[model samples]
Target: MTRRVLLALLLLGLAAGLVGAAAWAYEAWRDRVLEEGDRRGEARVQARWDEDRARAQEAALDKARQDAAETLRRLNQQQENERAQQALLAQLARDRDAARAAADGLRLRAAAYLDAAGCGHLAGDSALGCVREAAAEIGIALSRSAQIAQRVAADADEARSRGLRCEADYDALTLRLSML
Candidate 1:
């Protein structure tokens, strides 16, 4: 081939190589920009997801707090009911004890009355067997009366110690209970 033709062909080949290199560099730059944009888009989506998760967690926390408050309220109500029941029980017990004490006092008084009707100091008199029997009954009645009086006094003392006073003080505590 001619030298001039060969030189012209070499120049054309160099120009083609330059164009190819330029095209390859352009593609590489475009790919890098696209990768950067994809990374930025992924970061934005992740940030939005994190925000949504935080909001859901906050909502759950709020619900838990509400549930806890409700539980506390229910517990308080139950405790109040228990306290009321205990108070009622204590009052009933006090009433029952007062009634029993009053009954004892009345029984003692009745026995003493029966003895006064016939028995008393004439227990040794054999002329009237009935009178002797009455005297023995009187002795038993007096003893029981003393015991009842002691019990009544103790009950009044106990009531006072508990900060609950009986009417008429310690002496007539059972008498007031009998009226009730």
Candidate 2:
């Protein structure tokens, strides 16, 4: 071949190699830019997910705190009710004791009056003995009646306290439901 023709062929081959290298470099730069954009998008998605998770956890914690508070309130109310019941029972016992003492005193007074009126001197007279026996029987009946009445009062008080507690519990449940 001629030298000029050989040199021209060599120059053409060098120009083609330069073009191929430039295209490869551009493709590499484009791939790097795309990869960086993908990385940035992933980071944004992860950040948003983390924020959503944090908010959900905060909401759960708030709900738990509310539930705990409600439970504590219920427990405190129950304890107060128990204390009130104890006080009521103590008062009832005091009243029962007082009533018993009063009844005993009344019985003693009646006996004294009977003795003063000559009812105790009934050894010979049948009518006087019958009257004394009737009076004693009446006194025994009255004592029994008083004891029964006291028992009934105590039972009624207990039933009333139970009903009040049940009502309170129902109200608490209703209020909680309404909040939900």
Candidate 3:
């Protein structure tokens, strides 16, 4: 009877040890699984964050490129406008010079006509008629000179106005660019 009891007790101790070892192995496995799951979740979150940051950076770069393009376009347009204004100013100068030359030519012609009328070598109605004709031509030349002078003045005024307008436009564009 003593030998039977000893054998039964040894068998029970072996069974308990195996159950305890199994329980410990199961706990270790559960901890490993949960840790792996946490690592995978952290990796997914990091990937999403990197993607979001890249997208935001790309968007900012795209906007910068667009803004640069717009600035370039405006600068080009401003240059063209300045060139056109300069051309207009140059043409106005030429026109004013031409009108002045015409007026001067008319004045010279009027003086020549008056000098021709000072012919004291001729006498009688024929000489008087020649003087009268010379005076009439001088009057016409003087009137033409006055008209040309008026035209020159008008052109000068127009050029001044255009120059002022160009200056104002440039100033406004500069101010707007500074704000940007």
Count clashing pairs, candidate 3. Answer: 0
Model 1 steric clash pairs: 119-134, 119-135, 120-135
lDDT of 3 by residue, 1-180 (tens): 878888888888889999999999999999999999999999999999999999999999999998888678667767776776777767776777787777777767765655676633343577676876666676677777677776777767676857776785676467657877
Tens digit of per-residue lDDT, candidate 2, span 1-180: 688898988888988899999999999999999999999999999999999999999999999999898888777777776777678778877887888888888888888888887788654588778878887987898789888978887788778777877777666556666877
User: Measured by TM-score, how close is model 3 to the native structure?
Assistant: 0.61
Sort by lDDT, best first: 2, 3, 1
Q: Show model 1 residue runs off by greater than 4 Å.
A: 1-11, 119-180
TM-score of each: 0.54, 0.84, 0.61
Best by TM-score: 2
Q: Find the candidate with the highest lDDT and give its number.
A: 2
List lDDT for all candidates, in order: 0.67, 0.83, 0.76
What's the distance in Å from true for residue 109, model 1? Answer: 4.2
Per-residue error (Å), model 2, residue 41: 0.8
Better of 2 and 3 by lDDT: 2
Q: What is the C-alpha RMSD of each candidate to the true structure, in Å?
A: 13.6, 2.4, 7.1
In TM-score terms, candidate 1 sits at 0.54
